[model samples]
Target: MLSTEDLALLEAIRETGSLSRAVAHLGKAPSTVSYAARQLEERFDALLFDRRRYRLQLTPAGELLVNEAARLMQDVARLTQRVRQVANGWESRLWIVTDELLEFETLIPVIDEFDALQSGVPLRITQEVLIGVWEALREGRADLVIGATNEPPAIANLRWMQLGEMQWVFAVSPRHPLAKAKGPITRAMVAQHRAIVVADSSRVTEGSTYGVAGGQTVLAVPSMRAKILAQCNALGVGWLPRHRVGLATRLVEGTDRFI
Candidate 1:
């Protein structure tokens, strides 16, 4: 493999058109440049220069190496610039995909604060369910997603680290008697009252216990928002992801409320 100094020496020779000038430009003795060039010529089994006492001149092969060396130097310059730019935060777009419910609380504020300090670090948020969110990141479409993953699908390319667990809860429309029920509302009791089940997944959009059915009557909807909206519209009781709860849900007061 050609070393960086070898390429530099080749480029210096082309620029100055003299071995002595190239060595002087490097602040090194001319013999060092001559020796390095000797090594390069021996490695390639070719003459690098048509040497004359007055000044150095390029042979045909030397001319080719000089031109190619110039191209290589340009590439090295661009690579150095790119590295410096990254170190200075020149490319700072952060792509995020998360359950839409994040707008209400923690994640939103964190993002807001990040934007305040690092306005240059732009963040773009998109809505995606757990697996789809992970898929987006895997497909190079997103940087990360904040949501629970369980029995996660087997994908060789996917990678994730569980940050922490979230609290879980069940909710019903305030109009439901379960909201006012005094003591343990037994599973049988809950079954008796028609709970507004959320068919919209966006309502049930927290990152926990997904795909685990809780309600006796279940309705499947597309997003967490839609699921919660269906509940607002007097749909069946929603087995909501606790964090996904909106302002109005009445937390069912009892154990065995969730499965």
Candidate 2:
């Protein structure tokens, strides 16, 4: 049976790409590391490393073992963390709903920090738009909601906090007629073209829309990012979050003139 140390040794060699480097990382002498690897290989009577090039390359059998070991180690880690969490009386799961306007990438560091705590609280994240966030909380679909824009309805036992304001700007592609139209754009001018809008993800609520003037052709998208891309491509025109406009500008700078 392979031990955790043996699996760790395989992982180190895979990461460093050299036994000498891997040994330094493991804080073991080169000879000792080599002896351990050889013993492991001999137990199965199969070559673990190619040993042809100067670099540490895994053989077919070695590759298989290392890959399987990685999954096994992940399972072991999660199991250990879950046990520790149960002892500490932590929750089994946490459901979170975030507004579509907020960038999900910003939550990466927060998720990493949470994982480090070994809280064993499995996180389930879902995206919502406008009133969908409130619907999620009201219907018990989510335990917490982030980036809720509107005031919650008069309901008992509801809690909320302000998370700052989100700025929006009406944008158009330079190739679009509105971009070249003289003076400020009016509702009539906007009505002549298609408006890009993200569909609200609320199931219970009827959902909401903004900046779509009366009689304007609507092109509904799944996410805020998609709406921005549609506008950049001149597929439709609509308001986009201020910060996302910069990225959209860069994306279409060379190929298309995005205003």
Best by TM-score: 2
After TM-score superposition, the amount by which residue 160's alpha carbon in candidate 2 deviates from its true location, in angstroms, is 1.2
The TM-scores of all predictions, comma-separated, are 0.45, 0.65
Judge candidate 2 against the unseen true structure and give its global Cα lDDT, from 0 to 1. 0.86
User: How close to the true structure is residue 106 of candidate 2, measured as C-alpha lDDT?
Assistant: 80
Measured on C-alpha atoms, candidate 1 has an lDDT of: 0.66
lDDT score of residue 60 within candidate 1: 96
lDDT of 2 at 74: 84
Q: How far in Å is the alpha carbon of 125 misplaced in model 1?
A: 0.8
Estimate the Cα RMSD of every predicted model relative to the unseen true structure. Answer: 13.0, 8.1
Cα lDDT tens digits for candidate 1, 178-207: 778898867776665444432222232443
Deviating ranges (above 4 Å) for candidate 1: 1-92, 116-121, 151-159, 177-217, 241-246, 249-259
Indicate the worst ten consecutive residues by lDDT in candidate 2.
250-259
